[model samples]
Target: MGDYHVRFCESLGVKFPLATRLEAKQIEPGAAVAPKTYRFETLWMALNQTNHERYTETNALEQEKLLDKILVGNCLSFFKSLDIFVEA
Candidate 1:
């Protein structure tokens, strides 16, 4: 998971944050919705590392916006896994 984050940050040309919301996702397996599992393949399934490598190697500044969108989507998935509720 850390390796994936490292690669992702590198690909995005961004420094990693000291605290990441991904920590919640990593520690809580019960958070996943569909399969109820938080496997690497499941979390990273949509990402094609090969394509990302080629894209980053090209140094496409224009794609940073797209990458930010992808990161936002990933964060949303993590947020969705949160069990936030209230009972009165």
Candidate 2:
């Protein structure tokens, strides 16, 4: 997961801010293919690391699970899982 975070940070040219948000319009050329790549990294984080950020601890793992499903284009599973991890 640390490796995933490193790659994600490098991709976005930003430090690992656990709860950072990246909208599509905010994506730079450096971020080409990064959305998918980051989804992969987030999946890895959820599957392998402990959640530490105050903003993420509530549903971090579930978010990753949904991300993985969505990235794979599994719409049904994605929505099903998404409902479980909605942020407060």
Candidate 3:
């Protein structure tokens, strides 16, 4: 998952700040069992610019401690969405 995030981020020229699987579970014991995509809260979308840039540049090792706050806030805002095609 770390590799995937790194590759994905590199392809887009952006930083990857998500927690690794083990770190995520440690941060929220049952997070591993949740859906791959999370539903972020409104306040997560409301952080200020300076704070956002600071977290985005924070070292990946230290970022783990801030992952839940940082990633959930920016994932939807930062990433492009794909239009999935479902076969009828």
In terms of TM-score, which candidate is strongest? 1
lDDT of 2 at 62: 70
Tens digit per residue, CA lDDT, model 2, 3-73: 78679768978775454565456532221343342334333333333323433555768766655654445
Clashing pairs in 1: none
RMSD (CA, Å), each prediction: 11.6, 13.5, 13.3
lDDT of 3 by residue, 47-77 (tens): 3667667768989876666766666545444
Candidate 2 has a TM-score of 0.20
Of candidate 2, the 10-residue stretch with the lowest lDDT total is: 28-37
TM, every model: 0.32, 0.20, 0.23
What is candidate 3's local distance difference test score? 0.53
lDDT of each: 0.57, 0.50, 0.53
Q: Order the candidates by lDDT, highest first — what do you get?
A: 1, 3, 2
Model 3 / residue 20 / CA error / Å: 30
Candidate 2 global CA lDDT score? 0.50
